[model samples]
Target: MLMRPFWHRRTGRPAHPAAGAPGRPPRGVFPRMGTMTVLPPQIRQQPVERAFHGHVFSDPYEWMRDKDSPEVLAHLAAENEYAESATAHLAELRETIFGEIKDRTQETDLSVPSRRGGWWYFARTVEGGAHQVFCRVPAVSTGDVIADWTPPVVEPGTPMTGEQVLLDANAEAAEHEFYSLGSFDVSEDGELLAWAEDVTGDERFTLRVRDLTTGALLADEIPGTFYGSFLSPDARAVYYTVVDESWRPHQLRRHELGTPLAEDVVVHEETDPGLWLGAGLSADRRWIVVEAMCSEFSEQLIQPVADPSAPLQVVLPRTDRVLYEAEPLLLDGREQILLTHDHDAPNSRISLMDPADLGRPVAEVALRDVVPASDTVRVNGCAVTATHLVVSVRADTTLRVRLLPLAGLGTAAQADPVEPAFAEELYTASVSAAEHDAPVLRLSYTSFTTPPRVYDVFVAGATGDDAALPAEPLLRREATVLGGYDPADYAVERDWATAADGTRIPVSLVRRADLDPAAPAPVLQYAYGSYEHSTDPAFSVSRLSLLDRGVVWAVAHVRGGGELGRTWYEHGKKLHKTNTFTDYVAVTEHLAARPDVDERRILVMGGSAGGLLVGAVLNLAPERYCGALAAVPFVDPLTSILDPSLPLTALEWEEWGNPIEDAHVYRYMRDYSPYENVRALPYPPVLAVTSLNDTRVLYVEPAKWVAALREASTSGEPVLLRCEMAGGHGGASGRYSQWKDTAWEYAWVLDRMGLAGA
Candidate 1:
């Protein structure tokens, strides 16, 4: 499928909302009236700044570390009418839009690897904390039903209540708490069982064995878990990973059946476990792979069972920028294909690497090359054998599934490995992949705007496959797991918005289609003009509420982000970092010129490094935006980067430039440091959200920003604060807890925009 332009171009069709807000939109989606004037630059740039010498930013850094610029009050005062008009209608907007996707029954929880008798199973919690397991066992040799297991009923719904059938009263205490359960492995002869369970949610796990003949526990509690869930491959030995204070994997231990606890010790301890780890076992029980993560991407290391201590070898290592999933191939000759990032671009690439070679002798194949101008290439799925390797690569909006030769994982692979005619098509974000009983590849496809369909096809290996599993229909009566929204629901319109120097900048617009084209609809915009992280087009369902409302949404894919790939990212980083701040402003002006979006209704938002994006954008476009939200923002940029002792502080030097060691880098970061640049003025009403546990984006940064914004902003609009007590950089750990926190920020924004209504 060819990719279409983001905007209405070749189609020559008007982009309109198929459905508006739950309630009436403000004054309909049409252009409204408002007069605008280009203002002078906020920061008084001195001519001496051209040297990149002395204090980096023109603003006071050390003396007024906790202060703000008060001139923002005078700046915002110039655009008073747009703010007042938006405030009048925010209440109604909130009441109408908040309820669309907020309901307990409508919520969902996801975790895979379920337990059942044969192939396929459903793992989920029932009413009252009961754990149910549904399995899809083939009935009558052909009729495979994904139905109930315990009750043995063939209904449209999934199966559950496994404890009742798989175990008796002796095994299951009257009110037994089934802490954990699963189908460990089916075995070569397809007999016997080895599953695991942990009474607690922590890493403590027990490997249990049951006779496919009698279905009973083979041994006592699989001892105490050393680090993570104990894994039992075949009934021979159990393998597991252990984590220390920093949650780093350190050891991989093994235990044989009938062996005394004393001697059955750790078969291997990853020497550089701090930088690497492994636990997943191969189907043939000949290999094991562990994943390792660092400041950058993580790599997977594999060890042969015969030489379990073979020097740490990489199966899928982060060589470039992207992280690839090295899925274990369950064929006669077990192997793995590496998912890698493009070395020269922002896209992702897929290659095959043999786990045997300590990753020294490499075999890399580019599944999808980087699209010259676009940042959209990701590998999805692959099935490898001794003779062939079937791969799934996602680019743009489509998934192309191809079959390559098994030798691709080795230097011996044939030159032309891909089968042109056999390649199949699947939609991106819709398909789900899972291994069946044999070498059958299951393809599950669904779309936010489409229903789900599953396909089980026979992928040829060294030994030819004669029968392919029939395509099955996955009837999901309800709307798909996808939302009727996409990142494209928001538009990117680059235009010239002049700065104090008369330099025009670019801005991206992301708003609901049915908005008043000229009414200055409440807008929530985001940007991150630092680090080479490319903020390309990506889907996120959590942001739909803002887009659903008449409020407009935008992301300033400024210079810092690698949206344009490596070169774009490199240009904005290092000494040229200020371009990030300026690029963010250019985006604001482009969107502000759109009639439906009121300049006064504009709101700036960003987090972490992006927090800096919002902070700078708010100050630069102070007269345009009504409010600002800097989440765990990097306010004290220069100071934070200079302190190597802090966690992530040292790692960010490569991103912000090693200011501590290099004076030139120091001046570059100092120039746009959000905390240092807070001028004395009435700044926009900002809610600075930070987290104490966020080591990446320090809590002090946002805390200082909030304090400064309060002093600088002349507007009585609330400059508030919300600091997550226990959560990490992400803010929330649990699914429900995440939504709760997000709702608070969203509710506040809607109310502030005068959209919160009855």
Candidate 2:
């Protein structure tokens, strides 16, 4: 298996020194590094504005069309130069940091023969980059040599290592830049091979099958506008989903394994406008299920797909009460389906669905919320068995994946309830990785106090039930630098800040415990609170830099996220979108209330959608913060969503609502649209960063937003624009590079908060 390493500051672990860490904390406290650094005067001159009229919607980039405008060309040229510099600087920085880490590390990843049966063809990462080559892991755990792996095979008398092969493959893939291998499927009989890969992160994929025995290409190429492609159980067809022109979700399609690609087929479709698309196929490929999670309700349907275009029977109709989660599994010695769902009540349950009666699953099995962690809710899917399930549940920051029986669950079911398989632990087990011996061994690791590790686990049944899972951890790095640094060294607690509407928003604050409670240090607060996603507890390296420097770091778990469950998300989005920005503002205000932390010491940071929150706040309370770091931000909400021609504009209407067609939604988006609200106001130091190749929240959004703010804001708070020339919506592809980028971004923010190098 390709090994990847991560560096982080864990909350509840022992710390080791760095490869060459120099000094220790003063009096056991990290001294601030910005004792001599100073903020630029231009930052204090930025202006602030709360609202802008509709006429402000005119495209700010229209000036660029005037080629004769030397001003525009000069600006563009400078930006292009800056982009190049960012990449160059990142490469250098990553090399320095990773080199230090590598010196103190042993294994980056390992190749182990796990209990899971899904280990025939595995992948291994090459040495130089974030690329990997496919290889079949030896059937035995190279035990003491567990850290060592037999690289990929090429040809006779060839000594090329896996990394070398992957380097060439990555180079080859770069040539096309449009298609490469994703997941390759070798038939059960080991005679056929099917592979799928897209243009990087975009959902569209290409599926090509080859005769493994003869090393000959078999099926004609199939192009998809969506994700999730797998070979059918019979091995006669390839099935996957497609995104239509309108960006609407379509059904599972089947293509013939032989040449002359089969006709495009739709296995199922949900026509309800109220219901957005959510469909999945069973693991064994016997049934295809369709479901959608609406603003206030959800529904699901299942069908057997012998013929890809065949209509599916109604399974679980639309309902606000019961939420059905799809699980891919084999049951009754056949390809069946297991599910994780919540009933009309708040509780969650598991169910057994037969492939034959997918339209309506008769067996509704309710498992006890055994070892239940209240906030612990499983992510979207389930690990299935003929009649049981292994589930990963989460409550707050703690998570667990347990096994539950299918019979006698909730309704009239006969299956038994399994025991709580695993207890709460740190870091989510790394993506359900590694399978062997009919038992799927999942490597999941997290840090309660130290960096994460790779844990090998056996799914009691679905993936395979190999008890006494042979456990092998992939890699570990010494956090010796953190040995003297303790979470208790700083005071950590939760407090509530009241919003403008008297809504109480909870904020988690961490700072030097010895500092007087009345002393308000430069506080750095982060918030997300949208997309039903929670910014819960996880190990953070940059946060350590803050704590080390005596800067207070806090997390505002405001509404609009599933943090507090579905209700929290619903309360902050939809007609309540304003609640999100408002809640964030409340947290900032509360943190700034301390005497030690002055207005000039407070700064806010967020990325992507969270970028929207920070932008809105800068407009809402522009004077309250000393600086704002919005990375890969989504600022042009109003305009980006109106133009359907834009990549995700049409599809996003479901998330942000269609303002063009619905005046109500339009007004809502307009009220909070950061781009539209940008006015001639003095602002704090604003650093706008983005990735040039980002498909989501196009780089154009930040570029245009920065330009507008530059032309409008009175506060010169250096409206710096830093764009990554070769990255995607994910920021960067390399681990070391990502860490350096984060460190630099944090370093800059520290400078703004008068905490630079401090």
Candidate 3:
């Protein structure tokens, strides 16, 4: 006997809402401005109960998960139509915001050229073109390495000498409704190119090879390959990964250029459902490095490229709780392994080890520490060039880069590293491109109030860390802004909010300079507190529209993020996950109490895991916000995590506890899960944006959440859901479509803040 859900028995609504008339929706569903009252779509509640670990809960909208069913598709369409009719008044504001964004952006531009072998690689975007054009010019190098490595100056509208167009993505995107480039890699010889494309936005790509000389694709075509696939150094083979039925990338394979698809070899297979596998050629092009990792731990293996069919050697065996990444480096006529690991240091440290000592127990091998661990500094990553090693680190709440010479890299006489100076108090700077043998390191730098800039740091003449190369960084290019823009018009600053546990959460604020803190203004608060992923401050051209309209923007650096270091992330996951939600609420309360902010006009926003944060916080303090935006939210987490067959569900067990095996975890998740905890409160208006093909955080999660909110809310505010019919995790594919998406969201935010007329 099947048991009916509690909601079904309590409400007694019909399973299907009959049309008021033939070929017409219910009268209130698509009401006009002055003609009829606007009503949200009334979703049907089917009888479904999930019983696990002695807990039974009603799932009214579980049928929405069947994405291929006609009923589900029709419901999604109705939801979209309702959202459009409700916001029909904002059509003018959306268009105006989109125009402002397009006007400030230089539609036609060229990126800074980067040197590879004998060519300078760069991308060009023509006006009105939705996709980029990959092209390159012949390289001209002099005997002096520093002078030879400097990037050549090229104007945006002018053509460079000996330039060749490799690929025009516009022509390829014209064939599909949605298009995304999965992988783009050129062989070391610079003659063969390996690329991939995804048309349906499901993220399953098909690989293809192209000859640069003749501009013709070969007969070699492999489907269902993952991103980051690359060609071998000799240009005779390609290496890629394939996802399993659960969408976990677990198989690493190699395909010879002229072989049949069935003959492709599986280099390594990761049977563990919790781990994701990836393979790439080392920077020096001497070895193929394969790695399998999860949120808490990882293991690495390596194979010499000299023997394409050689067996993979274990560089580091799997340890229960230790995480590490090992890269091969050729130094002083010998090969050494550079490892960044969290063995004893919570914030990772760098060390060097010999290749031959691998495959032995990690405790039995000796390691030379090049960059020692520090409680104050978090080493993010390291990159090596022919002359120096560039280490990216997080200190004082911002990302910066340090340079260490390789002359005495692993020895006792190694000199102290050099840290470059930047003018801004908060900025992101890191190595953008570094050819293994190139003399200059290319850096991409930006901040909240600064445009993107490229620089070339000369390091060819330096002998050791203490040696001086060049004091001034050579500026290559700064992204162009079509309209007259001045950084002085805006002000950026940092503030602190006290959490329940006395921890100070960092909050970044940006707005127009003329706005006075004493005068209250509408505010939009954003955050993402999960997966140890940091939401660093960045410059946004579209955001100028919000700031220029006298609205303040804020970013809450809450727990469960890598912003403050490993401990910050540790305190916000698993059992401590509530800290993420509380930290965000604390920040919101702090903003409401500020003299510069209007307490009644504050709005909150987040996407993906951040959307989870938004959902939890709304349930905690719904009155603190006037509106909210959750993009591709993970609302029904316990249900997804309990079922291991779902996409990437097993991989998420480490981040969120295994609710199926642990009783405490199951109850804790149920207490916080947005769909399960939508109590009868005066919930604010919510706009959930999702994609029909988003595999990471499925559209079903948001669909269920919206239905629950509409059912339980005490306030009359509308809860709308906008699902993209043909898009992936990211909404639509092209730049113009993305601009329109941004405009739509921003216009809604302004309307809620009573600034739509501004």
TM-score of each: 0.62, 0.74, 0.94
Candidate 2 total steric clashes? 65
List the global CA lDDT of all models.
0.49, 0.55, 0.83
Ranking by lDDT: 3, 2, 1
Global lDDT for candidate 2? Answer: 0.55
Per-residue lDDT of 176 in model 3: 81
Tens digits of lDDT, candidate 3, 602-695? 7889998889888999899998888899988888898899888998889998899999899999999999998889989888889999999988
| Per-residue lDDT of model 2, residues 411-518, tens digit only | 445444333333333234434543212333344544423434434333443334234334433333223333355545655666788888887776767665665544
lDDT of 1 by residue, 1-758 (tens): 11111110000012433222334333222222111133212332222212233544333323322223354323223223333332333434433333433432224322233322353333333322224432333322233323221113323234444322333222332233224342244443334455555443232445555655565556634644433343444446666555444344556666665676565666555544224354565433456656554323556666676664476566544554334445455433454444443444344454444445434423353342211223554343344433445555544324455555444344443444442222122123222432333444444544322233444444444224333332332233322233333434444344345544554444444555445553456667777665444343433444566666565666666776544444456667777677777777766666667666665566778887788777876666676666677777877877666654544454465566677568867666666777677776656667777554554565656655665676577664556566564545666433344555566567667655555441
Ten residues in sequence with the least summed lDDT for candidate 2: 1-10
lDDT: worst 10-residue window of model 3: 2-11
Report lDDT (Cα) of residue 153, candidate 1.
Answer: 31
Tell me the spans in candidate 3 whose CA falls farther than 4 Å from its real position.
Answer: 1-36, 462-469
Error of 3 at 317 (Å): 1.0
Preferred candidate (lDDT higher): 1 or 2: 2
